[model samples]
Target chain A: MTAALEARGLRREFGHVRALDGADFDIEPGEVVALIGDNGAGKSTLVKALSGSLAIDSGELYSDGKRVTIDSPAAARALGIETVYQDLALAPHLDPVQNMYLGREVMRSGLLGKLGFMDHAEMKEKTQRAFADLGATVRDFTAPVGAMSGGQRQQIAVARAAAWASRVIFLDEPTAALGVVQTRNVLDLIRRVRDRGIAVVLISHSMPHVIEVADRIQVLRLGRRVATYDAKQTSMEELVGAMTGAISQEEAA
Target chain B: MTTATEPDRDAAAVDEEKPKSTLQRLVGAQAFQILGVLLILIVLFSIAEPDAFLSINNFRNVVVNVSILAIIGVGMTFVIITGGIDLSVGSVLVFSGVVAAKTMEALGGQGVGVSIVGALAACGSGTLWGLFNGVVVARLKVPPLIVTLGTLGMALGAAQILTGGIDLRGAPTVLTDTIGFGRLFGQIPYLSLIALAVIVIGAVILHRTRFGRYTYAVGSNDEAARRVGVRADRHLILVYTLAGFCAGLAGILNLAFFSSTTIAGQSNTALNVIAGVVIGGTSLFGGIGTIAGTVIGLFIPAVLQNGFVIMGVQPFWQQVVVGAFLIAAVYVDQVRRAAASRGASTRRSLFSRFSRPQGARRKEAQ
Candidate 1:
């Protein structure tokens, strides 16, 4: 299968620190890939670059093999790319529908233009489907997300990504603070999207989770891709070694 | 054994819960507190001065005077709900009046359509000042309090310059009498209805719209709002702009009521507007407020002032009462914040019941 998303020689510098150094990644369509790294390993830098939240000093990106530069977060979103940060971008005081429709609401039919209003009914209907398909049971759809469980809220964020996006998704530590059930739910969601021909790049520190959901894994160390492996070929210890800059070919010799 | 144990317990819990009645949940909501306070205040005032406090004439007088302040306070509620304040509103009010007065003067105050043109021109100037304060606060990332304070002086100076540091006299009488005295809904003063309409509209905008939700979200936690892709600064700019426009409206109302620009009218307008917002129960620190609360707050001082004047109470006592009210409201707000935070921390575990699976697992395992 052709790569749905690819990053070539991506380099980013943040003042005195080099966050990314010519990192290259290629994600095939319908693949669940984990971009694994320890803290400060340029995982976020890569994520931002892909999501159009940060600029790269050098490199090229391709969505569906067409070269592209993400100008802004909105631009990235427009190109069927969505990123759910570890700090989920869901607004607490707003209901899931409102949070989902932030910056992009379905405008209702109106006359004289004065009656312009949000087409909440349509948004609610679409959001409900995404939640139901994902097996998220939100008892109160109208409850402000602040009142929802963390897992349920995460589901809403994922649902938001899934509903409005079709090409690729970046999940940043999606199960970091989730319960076992929620972890299972999110892992299942990862698989479901891959089944639908969508490419997913999941960022996670959890070895077991990466092993379970990812079809491929790319480990980053000190702003470089230390290694890439088939999910089944990698072990937790090996990944850990790569992350901590140990167990390299030179180190082994 | 696990199934038998869980099934029996689950059934019992299901029977016990029945998904909680809507009324019970609603009665325990945050908005209920406002209703409770309003009821209590009504009862207390009725008992404190039965004849005067409950009279129709006194009520009309209270509403007419308070309407102007409430008109501005309602907009301030939106600004405060976004974790921002617009102190320049008073000066914006003065500035707007000067614009209207000049417009009226330029029209010679006697043309067939001068009132219409002057009203629009005056209100537009106020809107512009509001937009200025909003833009500076939103785009410059300045602390709203500081920006508004700066604009307050600037707006006042501008007003002085436009009117040449003197009260603009002989505002068109038609606009003045109509705004201040014309009956719109049966017998109520037009100003009172206008204030009511503005407050009602503001309340709907704050409570019902996506913009309203964003304001509350920004005020509650700005980081969370930004993460949600909310243009926090942009929304804030709009909020202050809306507030400034409202301030201008207040200025027009004042000009129409007083029939001229009082170069110093705004010196106390900000004080009264902020005080009214707080008195109505909008937390000074932000996140929670209501137009309904502000409306009540605007009336409290107006009614008190009217009552004192009628009862032959010392005029100085009006100032004293207002000052005391300010102190008390702010004190209550601080206490309420403390209590709310404490309650939240204490109730953290209760909410984690389903919200965080990890927390639940850890708690269960423990």
Candidate 2:
């Protein structure tokens, strides 16, 4: 299958340190690709470049075999690329429905919408359905997300991406701050998102989670794609060895 | 995860309770706290001085007295909700007032017609100043507090220069008699009516429109807003400009009500308006508030001042009481924030402490 997203020769430098050095990566439609690496492996840098949150010093990004430039988060979103960041993804003061439709509001038709009035009921119903479909129970739709459990907040963040992401979704350590149960919920949610035919790129430090959900594993070491493995065939020891440079791919082969 | 399970019946009972309805939730909201306080204050004052404090004349007096402050406080609510401050509102009010007075004086003093023209001029000038502030803070990326502080001095200095430090009086009696003291159907003062209209309109714009959502979003988390394609800079500009326009309206009201621009030590007006907004429970940190709360907040000070004067208490004591209330309001806000975060964590701990349910475990094991 043709890859939905591909990045070639991604290079970014921060004066003395090279954050990203010619990283090459790709993800296919309906595939879960876990981008894993040790600290300073440039996993975050590559994710930022792909999500249009940062500019690579040199790189080529392609969507469906066509060259594309994502200059800003909005540009990435226009191409159906959405990201659930580590934090600051939702306004704490707003409700789930409000947070879900923050920028992409549905306006009421005729004079009311022309006057900039939001169709709140419609948005709320859709947001409720999205949460239910994701198997997440949001007890209070009116309470501020800040007042909700961390897992519920994560669910809203993921559901927001699922609703808008048509081409690719980047989840950046989505469960880093969550508990084990919440992490499991997020992993299950990821599988559901993948089953819906959208490409998912998960940036995670949890090895078990990466192994459990990812269809393909892409390991980055020192700002470059060191290896890609089929999840069913690869071993955690081999992946960790590639990340820490303990064993060479040639030796493993 | 199974090792962490705690079979607590109380926790299960807590989980089985039904969620609150919209009305029930609203009644318990942070914004309604001041409404209760206001009602209590009204009861106490009426008992203390029945003839004076509860009289119709005193009621109209207090309402009219707070109209200008309430008008400016409405805009301040929006600004504070967006995590910004506009210190120049008072100076802008004076500048716009002066502009209205001068425009009327220069327009042959033809009563209400010329006064209308002068009001438009005042609003336009105030809006321009607000737009300047918005552009400086949004496009140039200067901090809002500093940008507004600088404009404050400039606006006040311009007003002083325009009038040579002298109060401008004597425009037209019709302007004062109709707009200043006029009543709507002989029941409500025009000023009070205008303030009511502004409050109603402001509430709609804030709670019903897309612009209102952007205001809360930008204030709560600006980076998140930008990430979601909200033009934060543009929203900032719109917020500042709306504030300026409100100040301008307040300026015209000042001109009409007083028939003069008193440039003597009016710098504290902005602080008073901000105090009212804060007292209404709009967080200084941003992303929370209601126009109704602000109206109640403005009335608190107005009622206290009026009641004190009638009860033979010193006027200075009003300031002390208002200052105390402002601190109390903010303290309550901080307390609520702490409770909210704690509530979230406690719920999560309960969920995790219980581990997976039996049905989920069977599915997972399979």
Candidate 3:
């Protein structure tokens, strides 16, 4: 089967420094791929481009082998590509269901049409299903997300992605600021996403977690992909050397 | 003696939200202050004019007298809830009245079509001025208070220029007589009934629709709302437009009440409308208020002034009392905010304790 997400020659630049100077990465329909890089090594640049928050300067994106251009966040969503940023970008005062169905509320009436109301029942049912899939129970459906802990909020964010995503997902430093238990909860969620036959792209600084969860690992050093190795074959030291541009295929040869 | 640390807190936080909720329902709400004042006035006034002040006709007269301002206060509620103000509403009323009367005079007296055109022109002109204020504040990024203040001056000048400060005396009597004097449901004034109808529709628009939620959301946290794909700028524009429409209707009602349109009504209206809005329980800071509070707010002055006339109080003293009420209401709001802040800081302290280690690590987090 074709990979769920494939990048061919993705390039991006910020003024003088090249953040992403032609990169390609892929994940199979149910596999997890880890992208590791040092600070300012273009991890965020690639994440922003794939999430449709920033335009790619020069790149080709293929999902299930069909080329596509994502001009907006909605367009990326249309392709079933969900990206969870570090900040989570959730409305703190809005409940989980409200945060989940924010922009696309399930309304009974057509836009500017008769009835003039939102269908709260349909939205509640759909969100309940999402929560069930994430293996969590929200105590109060109307309680705001601000009242939730870091772990619960991440679960809601992941659930929101899985509810609509069909092909691939990206997680950007998802464990940042999370407690040990919270990190474990999110790692479990990442595994669950793959178990559902969806490809997962993980961006992280934690090398140990990467080696544990990733089927394959890709390393970027100053915007260029320097190495890719099967998780079973590579060591943490080898991965770290590739990530910092210290290892070269020519040297190994 | 034991000493206690009350707490250092963010006092302004609590006052920033709409108070139409359970907070306003609390006993000792400022709206109840008007009722206290009304009772005091009744007790003092009846001793002086025992027969006259207690008469039913005197009660009816007071309700009728305050009807104009109360009608306009309904419009102000919509404006203030969106965290904006309309200073030009009074001027719009005057300008509209002039247009309506001038239409009657120029149309050769009270024909049905002439009356309809006059009403539309007056209400329509007020709405047009309101739309101008909304566009400047919403799209052009001008402050609401300043834009409406500018329009207030412009509207007054336009009203004066339209008539050269002359009163349009010969208005169509039929139109005014029906609206001002006709009884609805056997005893209710026709104008009051119409005002009631407008208020019901307005309250529904503010409380029951998707439009209402966006209004509250924008006022609450604009950036958060926009990030969630809520078209905030567009929603703000719509809010201002709704305020303008209400202002227009208030002007038309004013014209129908008084046969002659006076340019001076605009002078006191902005302050009065804002005072009435805050009097009801909505916050001046934005994000938390309701039409119900506004209605209660409107009646405070209505009942107070009614009690004053029964005691033969001078008309100028009315302004003093209203001013005092405004200052007192603000003071109460300040006190309420202070207490709420103390509660908030206590909650924050509890949270800080729950995650003390996290706090220590956060400082070294870089």
The lDDT leader among the candidates is 2
The candidates, ranked best first by DockQ, are 2, 1, 3
Scoring only the A-chain of each prediction against the true A-chain gives TM-scores of: 0.93, 0.96, 0.92
Question: What TM-score would every model get versus the actual structure?
Answer: 0.85, 0.93, 0.75
Give the winner by TM-score. 2
Candidate 3 CAPRI level:
incorrect
What lDDT score belongs to each candidate, Candidate 1 first? 0.75, 0.85, 0.70
* lDDT at A230, model 3: 91
Candidate 2 positional error at A32, Å: 0.8
In terms of DockQ, the best-performing candidate is 2
Instruction: Tell me the spans in candidate 2 whose CA falls farther than 4 Å from its real position.
Output: A250-253, B5-18, B343-366
Off by over 4 Å in 1: A112-115, A179-185, A248-253, B1-31, B110-112, B162-166, B209-214, B217-233, B279-287, B303-366
**Which pairs, if any, clash in model 2?**
none
Report the C-alpha lDDT of model 1 over B1-366, residue by residue, as the tens digit: 234443233222222222335775444333344455556655666677789777887777777878778878877999888878888877887888888878778768565388777767767887787788788887888888898899889989988887779898757778776885777665788888888888888887887666777788788778767754678888887888889889888888888888768787568888888888887778677776777778777766776677666666776787897788778677656654553432121122222234655444323432
Error of 2 at B262 (Å): 2.0
Tens digit per residue, CA lDDT, model 2, B258-305: 888867746999999998999888989888888888888888888888
Q: Quote model 3's TM-score.
A: 0.75
Candidate 2 on A121-174: residue-level lDDT in tens? 999999899888877656678878877667778888999999999999999998
**Stretches of candidate 3 exceeding 4 Å from the true structure:** A25-39, A82-98, A109-115, A135-137, A143-221, A225-244, A247-253, B1-85, B167-171, B224-228, B279-286, B304-366
